[model samples]
Target chain A: MAKSTIKLRTKEKGGKIQVKALITHPMETGLRKDKKTGKKIPEHYITKVVVEANGKPVLTADWSGSISKNPFLSFSYAGSKDDTVKLTWTDNTGKSDSIEKKVGEK
Target chain B: MKRRSFLKGSIAAGAAGAGLAAGILTPNMAFADDVADNPFKAKSVDEVLKMLGASGAESSDKIKIKAPEIAENGAVVPVGITSEIPGTTEIISITAKNPTPLAARYTFGEGAVPAIKSRFKMGKTTDVIAVVKAGDKYYTAKKEVKVTKGGCGG
Candidate 1:
């Protein structure tokens, strides 16, 4: 099972639910060489992020090795305050993480 | 100009704009009429557009990519994607020079601002391209971000 590596927060204001998420990952580009030993670093990155509310996806992100080590994303939608928001990510290496947050909880 | 006709015209324009931003009709589908699978899987920038079924993109004066001329560290170089083009429904970021140039892709819902802020890793200095999809067309802009320290396995 991949780790639950997402930190997410939601704010309800002015009839909209705003969401912000931060993910943790190495996001390494399969380049660079070891200084001590000559070997290339493996490429590892979170390639996709899907954000859903009440099972209806609102945002989907596709990324590459060029993304930062850890990525942060923020967006808002016209959703009910009682909706459940879920975030999930998958990497190029086949590892993944997912988390669920209820809007009114925070 | 007749008052009622003018009002109806503006309303129709606003509705069209909304329809354009709502390009991502479903959560699992983006540009529902254009694609069925993920286009970001594309290894090259051109493939991304092709995946989206875009006719073609042209250099534009409205798309803006904000990044440092010299990023102190490659680990997390902040980048801002802002498109002034009207009816922008999607934005695609490309590291035109990355080993695999298609960096990131995003779709905006109707009425949401067409601006994106994120960070990307730089293996070395490279030109960053931003492709904005507005209604049925695509526009592009680019900037060169020089990385002092290699972020990718450099």
Candidate 2:
């Protein structure tokens, strides 16, 4: 299998779970022109991101191409150690990737 | 062959009826789709807010936006938003001068916090606005970030 495009980490501190994710994508806005080709780059960016904790959706984000390339996201939730956290993102082109991590795990 | 065609027609009609019933039973199902429809196409912050079902937002001090007053590079400006208001269900960030002003929208569930940190691209100097939805009211905060360089490619 190809390497995953998402890197996720979850840590439990003071009975709260901090989730951080880094996703690798170009996040093209379709307005940029290629320097060499002088052609516009087609728009391609993540449209939706869903973060679930133990099978329950804790956060749902809708994003546009204004987000920087190689997006980094950090948020927290009220969760305990050993709980599972899953993050999934779908781009405008229908491409998607997901990753899961267990809280308090290295 | 006639009998088979008749059965197929009946099945298709029944499926369509069931779908219509489900759509009517869950109005939120349609509302969710409406909310997700082309929000990025909005050219201004007001249009984006309208698309999000918010009429207008009042300025508030409880919403804190953390961003540099002057950014050397427009390619990546780190921003953090924290809403002190209780029962915040949604948070939206917009770059006022971008070609498309709407940047990101986040909906928090029961166990989630109403805060996030992320990076956004700035074409030039612009006002970064944060909108927070608590209960049935919407509040907003704004911060100006001067960009020395443009991030969008020519």
> What is the C-alpha lDDT profile of model 2 across B16-120, one tens digit per residue?
788677667667956645533456878988788887777578899999999999999887999999999999999999999999989999999888989999999
Query: Which portions of model 2 miss their true places by more than 4 Å?
Result: B1-37
Where does model 1 exceed 4 Å of error? A1-3, A104-106, B1-55, B84-87, B109-112
TM-score of chain B of each: 0.69, 0.75
lDDT of 1 by residue, B54-138 (tens): 5368899898888899998977888888888988878888886666777888877644557777888777888888888898888
Steric clashes per prediction? 4, 0
Cα TM-score per model: 0.71, 0.85
- Candidate 1 clash pair list: A31-B153, A32-B153, A32-B154, A66-B121
- Candidate 1 backbone overlaps, count: 4
> Best candidate per DockQ, number?
2
Q: What is the interface RMSD of each candidate, in Å?
A: 2.5, 0.8
All models, RMSD in angstroms: 16.6, 10.6
Cα lDDT of candidate 2 equals 0.91
